[model samples]
Target: MSLSAATLRSLKHHNYRLWAGADLVSVTGTWMQVLGVNWLILSKTGSAASVGLSLVLQALPTLLLGLWGGALADRLPSRPVVLATQVAHAVLAAVLASVAMSDPASMTPVYGLVLASGVVSAIGGPALGRFGAEVVPREDLPNALALGSVINSGGRILGMSLAGMLLPFTGAGGLFLLNAVSFFAVIASILAMRASEMHRLVHAGENSGSVRAGLAYVLRTPRLLVLLALALVLGSLGRNYQVTMAAMSAGPLDAGAGGYGLLSTVFAIGTVAGGVIAAGRPRLTIGLLLGAALLTSVAQSVSGLMPGMAAFAALILPIAAGAVIIDTTVGTRVQLDSPGDMRGRVIAVQGVVSAAAGAVGGPLLGWLCDELGPRLTLEAAGAATVAATLVAAAALARLSNVRLDRAVLLPVRGILRRAPAEQAAALP
Candidate 1:
């Protein structure tokens, strides 16, 4: 089906437009930093383990403190929180850039700076995520979510491509400097937004509950719990395929850093396509989630078995498509299903679940690659993702009365009728 005016109606909102533009710029810088860090570690230590360790430092804080961050989002204006985080990030990027420039190629202080930057990211991620819900009208939440994905996918392509090309001249230090500068673009956009125009659903000191309340609410709701479980499996363990993809390209494909960048770009192309498709659709559905998850698992498996560069690139398209579909669907559904006061905490819980998965999955997959080889490790991870999909599907199926798609698309429309009041009421 083609995108019609009704499907694209969400663009009419001014705030969403502002968010889309800012996120596009900011996320591109984040992607550049990611690539630069990976390269920096590889150059310094010549070990995959160091690469994994850096990733761990970057992500471990999220797994550990995401819930607290979520609570903080609920207690304050998300825009201000985001603004503060961006400022801190910019400073950190500048520091790293300085360190990189002085040495041209240093490891010790670079990794330490990366670790410090990750601590900042851990604070930023939940605030950034929940901020979307506050930036646009509730009716446009799904559209905003889709647009966020579009911006992120596009950013990955832009940043990774630019980093690959610029690294020769700027080195890791220069890229870090560029990343620091990019944050101002986002900061300016955010500051330009009218405070009255911000669509915040929760004001300060509104939802006062112990963190346990958030946990209890999530557990009491089977559907939300199921979705979070799937996110953990796919986002964390299944995504390890990406790490392996880089390794395989550098090894079997003999593609080097440029080749790895190409794989990222290819995957991002599919992600962009998928985000566009999702934006033009009505709302999320359970069937769509299942289909996407299964497709992602199978596609990932296929990626593992590809023989050469062309084949690998071709296989990654479907895998990336499935990945974006799942991300957009889950992201939209979580916002739609949550109560206004509890939105931040719910989103935070989701973040924690996802971070936990990545924390465990990244190192696990990295270790497996070290032991079993990239090809076998990726193939096994894909199979495991498929099994997770099956389990998620079976669990969701039991909620037969729950109209999964409608719950996501028109959350205000009464799909919650199928859900128990206690499921929502249990929120702390």
Candidate 2:
């Protein structure tokens, strides 16, 4: 399918609208909180490593706790799981805001609160991933997933931009307050959706044994293993974008927080665009995975090397686009291929891999920034990513009967039917 034509048809699902609306408001709060959190830490400690350390604290728990979260999701209904999580998140945000405002000198407690919030989010991640399948039909799953990506990245863009504006106005404390309010907005939206609208995925033999069984399934399936490997490699390398870009933009790039915000915004723009394109595509294939990885790596390399701001910004667009495409394709595939009961665990595994990346990547990049510089770190990582992509493609091609053409990712078999080619192409 042509890219232009595919965009329109992917948006017919009602679920996507609800998801997008909540996400639009919530994502901005997330971005604002992130920006404020970083600044708050930096101002208090006056150390780069502290900034990195805080992120490590926030993400490290996910590596340890994500699988458990997935297991819980499998045992429970996702609606209540998500709803409860949203409430917890909102309360955490409120606490952070109160602490930040009442005791400006006590940043340590704030970090503790952020760490607590991270743990809550780690548990919530799998539920959020599985929720898409519940809300939309199988046929619209990919599109819904893609639109989710668009909403997520679009939220990042607008949120970060607004963060840039709001942080200076209200200080980090005020931003936290606004973020707290936004969480309530998301919670309200989620509650407003009809219970009948949430359809649970009933996979064959969903009465499963242990989390190890899910792992066993992944291990037994060569394609799934390949996809997992791709996810691991991509997470390790791609996670460096934030640390590297932040350091470069603020230091050698001399762009400051605003520049960092601009860089992230460009990436967000690419993400939304990529999500749109992937939604319209016929199916997920090894070729698409390889292409996305290679394109992202190449774009990263170019962006890292470019000395001019405009050049770097332009390079970021393709990189962001590629990253989102890889994410959208892999994410949808994982959702479709897994059993409903085990889908939570599968998504949890993905989250754990990504969280593991954050745990390791942040400190590694920070140390690299201190020694070799951000550009060198980015260049090396980008090269490694491209190499990993090639290896993944080769392994995928070796499968005896898994032809790219035979793998139909669209219509999410046994799911809902979308409008034909005409409906797939329109935006909105």
For all predicted structures, in order, the TM-scores are 0.84, 0.85
Candidate 2 has its poorest 10 consecutive residues by lDDT at 407-416
Identify the candidate with maximal TM-score: 2
Instruction: Give a tens-digit lDDT track for model 2, residues 1-428.
Output: 56565554444555556767887898889989998889888988898778877787788778888887887777777778888888898888888888777757756887798889889988888887777677777776777777777778878878877888887788888888888888777677677776776677653244563577777877898878888887877777775577787888977788989898788777777788887767766664445566667667867766678896778888888777778878887887787877787898899888887777666766677888879887887888888887887676656656644433222222222112433432222100
In order, candidate lDDTs are 0.75, 0.74
Kindly report which residue stretches of model 2 are placed more than 4 angstroms away from their true locations once superposed: 1-11, 203-209, 246-262, 302-307, 366-376, 400-428
Clashes of each: 1, 16
Residue-wise C-alpha lDDT for candidate 1, range 1-428, written one tens digit per residue:
34566446666767667777877888888888888888887887899788878877777777777777777776777788988988999999999888767764557787788777777767676678777777778767776677677788899889988998999988988888888998998788887777787777764354464466667777888889888888989987676556787788867688999899788778778889777766665565555667667767877777778889999899888777767778887887787887766677788787777778777887788788788877787788889988897777767766655443432223222222423212321111
Model 1 lowest lDDT segment of ten: 419-428
* Candidate 2's TM-score: 0.85
What's the CA error at residue 358 for candidate 2, in Å? 2.5
